[model samples]
Target: MSSKLNIFEFSNPSIRTLHISWVAFFITFLVWFSHAPMLAFIKEAFDLSSQQIKALLILNVALTIPSRIVVGMLVDRFGPRIVFSALLFTGSFLCWGFAFATSYEMLALFRFLCGFVGAGFVIGIRLVGEWFPAKQVGVAEGIYGGWGNFGSAAGAMTLPTLALLFGGDDGWRYAIALTGAIAFVFSFIFYINARNTPKGSTYFKPKRSGGLEVTSKGDLYFYLAMNIPMYIALAVLAWKLSPENLGLLSELATNTLYVVLLVLFVFQTSQIWKVNKEHLQKGVAEIEKYKFKQVAILNWSYFVTFGSELAVVSMLPLFFMDTFELSAVTAGLLASGFAFMNLVARPSGGWLSDNLGRKKTLSVLIAGLSVGYLVLSQIDGLWFIPLAVVATMCCSFFVQAGEGAVFAMVPLVKRRMTGQVAGMAGAYGNVGGVTFLTVLSFVDASTFFMVIAGCAALCFILVQFLDEPSGQMAEVMADGSVELIDVA
Candidate 1:
């Protein structure tokens, strides 16, 4: 494998995979967020109340937290090619359902289902990890993640105009269905072009299927402990939609969902134990062992970085509009800068992780994220608009860059479990979004910024405990022969 990446080298199979894989991810995001930009048209068409609109927003992310983990496991078992292609194809139908829904209930159901599309990010993580070497995986994964993430921004930039051009009450519907068509077509394109791994390279699979295989009994408990926050985040979302809050869901429905979540968590716990019981009892070979805390710390790091990005993107436009007394269009255009930075900022983080040590790079980026948010906590209407925009962009750079750094280490943790590792970290990012957004519900803008900064500071400290990836990981092949994969 070459130490240097020539992104323009299209003839290279790995480069081709990187380009097509990111486009697959981008289309999923485009479908996932297609509703957000055209919400005004839909609201007008359906006569939605403020509370109902809030419910739609909450429902949009309701399934994504768990879906990411599920997709991760699927990617590991089935490989990225099939799993990603299927997700894109299926997501298109959901987009169409949401676009053409005649009733609010129908709209809510499809939007919640659309949350599955967001898990498309997890599939590419495993795909990109397979194609790139340890030396270049950082930036390669960065370009995959950073550019793929821009799909949401791209949708926001273009979809509204598209709806307007379609020119009627049903224009939003047609515009959204068009996004679905692209996803459906691209699904076939990705499937036909993408390969799971390089020629002659083995695609390692997990020894057990159900849950992540932990090394020690202690790590087994730690893995279980780490999952509690994800369930808690889901519960918070349920509460927001419950009759006591937005009244979108009746008390009976909310309680039933709560019971369902509890049952699912118990079933998941058993699956984790099932996957690890035999291994822990036999005692894992030292050479085959990897620390579960590496996974845990990355989870928290992503929670701080990507989680804050989701929360901020949702609120920044409103924050700017109110704070500066600007029109909606003006505030929205200004706020777009934060998301726009992903194209460059994320790849730069990966480049730094590749050149600088991963741990050091991650730590510095997290610290920068903390400081950036702290600086944001001080912004006010008294500040000039251009300066505020610059401050917001600067803060987003660290947030998104930290996210890139987190995933850069994910594939290195356990080559076989890269899908699951990426999935868990990706899920935690949503957990962070839910947790922080919940905080924003009760606080001022400055307080919300301070809360994120405080959490980033704690994550910065946790990152110090990470042992740098400097050696090789040993994987047992199907024939019981050992294969060594490089991490450093």
Candidate 2:
């Protein structure tokens, strides 16, 4: 690692890799969310209810939680270039399938599977981490994440306009299909141009492929424990579509999914044990030992940070329209501001983490987010719209910035497991969405925001326990050599 590779000065190769990686992620997100802005059109086309629409939204993310874990392992083992490109190309096909779906069931199936592409975020994180040194990883990942995340915002801004330009009952379908085609073609370009690392740099491989390697017995148990929540989230989603809730799922189908989920959980736990059994018994060196609990804490933190962001962004427009008695168009534009903060605040969060300490930066951002949400909980039509906008914007900064800070620490946790680590953290974001949205069904919109604030406050306390990355992590190379990657 070299100080000369600070944020301002980096090799063109690193910069180019970052740019390409982020764009790849951006395009994936664009494809992932191309349906969102056109939901009204889809609703009309399908004659859907508000509940079914929400269920469709829920379905969009249902597969993502598990797909992220699978994709993470694939990236860690096979490298990001192949994994990401394959995801985009295959996901593009799914997007096209969704566009042509004549039945709601078929559309839901394709949209749910498209969630797999959301794991594109994990691939770019590992790619950017490989290209940049530890000193600059924060900003590089920040830029990668911030700019890449804007794809959803970009979709919100552009897809509707594109649909209008096409001008027909099926215009939304064409607009969405165009995004898929772009993703499909770019997948080939990404595969051809993107390298796992700069020439002459080693692309480090994990010791095992199927599961994460843990250094100690405690970490092994902790890893198993962390996996439980992901399954729980899936179960929650199933329940939401079950007869007891939205009634979109038959009792038999819902129960079958639950049983399958349980079996999958058991299989995953078995793989985890098999991968790390020897290492847990032999014991790793002190320098190589890192707590899996750190990853666990961040998992819960992101469940709130990015999770709330996802859940809130989905419902905010309707929340505004109902509460403020405003037009859908105006409410949607106002809600767009929440996601718009990603372009700047997310990078600012990472920059702050780099200048300050990771824990300190996370604590401050979480606190601000908690307070911001609390203030948001108090909003009413009596308040001025500008004041309301200010409140939302203030909360957006903390929420998106907190996301940047959380990832600031992600790459630092374990180098070999960075993809898996990031993947799980990312899964929790979906988990939070499922969890918070369930709460929203039971409570008022104001209480929903307050619930997230409470969750953030709990995560803030947990942030105090994280050990800042400062020294180095040792990764054993294939040639019986040890490579020291900087974590400071």
The C-alpha stretches of model 1 lying farther than 4 A from their native spots are none
User: Which candidate ranks first by lDDT, i.e. highest?
Assistant: 1
TM-score of each: 0.99, 0.97
lDDT of 1 at 27: 94
The residue pairs that clash in candidate 1, if any, are none
What is the per-residue lDDT of model 2 for residues 1-488, given as tens digits with 9 covering 90 to 100?
A: 54333444435778878888889999989989989989999999999988888788888899999999999899998999999999999988999999889998998899889898899999998998888777777777888898999998999899999999999899999999998999999999999989988788777777877788887887788888888988998999999999998888999999999999999999999888888887767878787788887898889888888999998898889888988999999998998899999988888888888778888999999999999999999998888887898899889999989898888889888888889999999999889988998898899988998999999999999989888888888877778788888788
lDDT of every model, 2 decimals: 0.94, 0.88
Q: What does each candidate score in C-alpha RMSD?
A: 0.7, 1.7
Worst ten in a row by lDDT for model 1: 1-10
Which ranges of candidate 2 are over 4 A from the true structure?
1-11
Q: Positional deviation of 367 in candidate 1, in angstroms? A: 0.4
Among all candidates shown, the one with the greatest TM-score: 1
